[model samples]
Target: MRLEELISQFQKKDKKAFGKLYEMYAVNICGVINTIVRNEARAEEICHDVFIKVWDNADRYDPSKGRFFTWILNIARNAAIDELRSKSHKREKLNLSTDFFVGILERPEEDDKRDFDSTRLKKMLGKLKKKCIELIEMLYFRGYTQQDASEVLQIPVGTVKTRNRNCISQLRKNMSAS
Candidate 1:
């Protein structure tokens, strides 16, 4: 069944539908959170909270508003952004630089973790150019707009879209190969 069908059933309190939705989106949701939070455990916690928010706000969803994935992405991003703005995060920021998601790839312990399967992710990323990775990390993972990424990366604005599209295509190919 389609995601919209499942969502409709879920709105009626169908457990099976809800379970299917969870299973389908859990990894994606976690990945989105991890991109923002940069901590696996905290990302997992936020992932759960995001789903709960989605469930509780089911009635508020409007098909005309946007794609379901886009909606959930907004919720997950907002939650992760909120966490970053919290008091505890403020304390942690005093000691560490506010690096983006690509920095996580360089963490030795995180790279070795089986739960995150960082090795596989690294291999997939290996297929992409360094510039592609940077562009993707800035635009998608760190939530930078095209204008923002262009300014930060010192590239043309049009380059941001083309570069991001190419990067995502490379990622899709890598995923298919894996």
Candidate 2:
């Protein structure tokens, strides 16, 4: 069956269609989630949740706005990003306490290297314009959505998107030249 027909049936809550769609897209979707969340097991779990979300909200999709896969991809991306921003994930990542004999479980040299990398990152951002720094801090460091950044920056969403792309490009150039 063609993708459109499958999607239509999915929107109508057809189980077979949903199953076929999952078979078709699950691997790719899980891979993307893993890339963002960096945990294979968690990515699979989040992928399952994203599919459930997709199934539940199937009727909300508008083909005229974008492709069905893109809609699902956006949902997966947002879910992965949300997982990254979650407090539980933060706590999981913050398990850097000293071991009984190891002093810091993470080596002191690695810690110093991380501090140096942070200082270098700060220097790079300092070289960028104030607007670029603010945009990077919001979209990357603080995990603001593009729409949220747009509202906060008082710019259109498209403008925020454009600025983010341009700013990242400039940042890449700065890093490469150094």
Candidate 3:
């Protein structure tokens, strides 16, 4: 069946449609979560939670606003970001002090080699303008709000917003080129 029909059925609470959607997007969604969280198991858990959230809010999804995958991706991204911001997640990282210290001592020069995507992301950021790179780092990587970024960058919030949109667009272009 077509995606539209499948999504329609999903929104109507069809279990089979839900299972099909899960099978189709689980890996991609989990990968995106892992990109942000850097924890495969946690990413997988969050991916499952995101699907459940999607199922619960199925009726809210409007195709006219965006594609289904884009909607689901945004949800997954936000969920991963939330997980990063949670206190438990922070504590878990704090609990990794031994591993962190060991890693630093053992591979000080290969910090960028911790993950292939980290290196690739660094390369992608290198392709962007200095300002865009800074904005992307602050807004996305550091989880700064627009107002927070504006305050830190000493710019108006509106400018921060516009720059963020432009930077993401540029990044998308660079990613496609690569």
Candidate 4:
């Protein structure tokens, strides 16, 4: 069934449709949270919270505003970012190294066991250049704007958009392949 159909069913409080939607997006949502929190357990907790938020705010979602993935991506990112800003997260003094999400991708053993369809993502991400990874991390994961990414990466502002487009294209290819 189409995502819109599933969403309609979900709006009607259909448990089966909700479960299917959850199954489809849960891992990706968790991945987004993990990219921000950099802790598997905390990311999982945040993922649950994001789902709850989505359920509570289901009436607010409008298809004309954006893609369903984009909507949920924003929710997950906002939730994860909020978690980072919380008092406990601040007090913990977590070291957000330069690599951030890249560090997670590079951890062969742990990334293998934790992330869903790890091998596929590893292979897809492996095809991307280091700069592509960095740009995607900054722009998508870290919520940096084009200007911020360009300044941080020392690239021209014009390059940031194209670079991000290319990076997402690679991700799309990987998603299709998997």
- Indicate which candidate wins on lDDT: 4
Candidate 2: tens digits of C-alpha lDDT, residues 1-178: 9999999999999999999999998987886676566678898999999999999998999989998877888898788878776746575653211121122222454575642344454445546776776676566534468998898889999999999999999889888877
Instruction: Encode model 3's per-residue lDDT on 1-178: one tens digit a residue.
Output: 9999999999999999989988998887887677567788888899889999999999999999999987888898789878777846665542211122122233444665665435455445546666776676555434467887887779999999898899899889878877
lDDT of each: 0.78, 0.74, 0.74, 0.79
Screening candidate 3 with a backbone cut-off below 3 angstroms (N, C-alpha, C), the clashing residue pairs are: none
The global Cα lDDT (0 to 1) of model 2 is: 0.74
Give the winner by lDDT: 1 or 4. 4
| Between candidates 1 and 3, the TM-score winner | 1
Backbone clashes in model 1, listed as residue pairs: none
Quote the positional error of residue 95 for candidate 4 in Å: 8.7
Worst ten-residue run, lDDT, model 3?
94-103
- Candidate scoring better on lDDT of 2 and 4: 4
Could you tell me the TM-score of candidate 1?
0.79
Give the better candidate number (3 or 4) by TM-score: 4
**Candidate 2 ranges beyond 4 A from true positions:** 88-178
- Distance from true location, Cα of 95 in model 1, Å: 12
Better of 3 and 4 by lDDT: 4
- Model 2, position 64, has a per-residue lDDT of 91
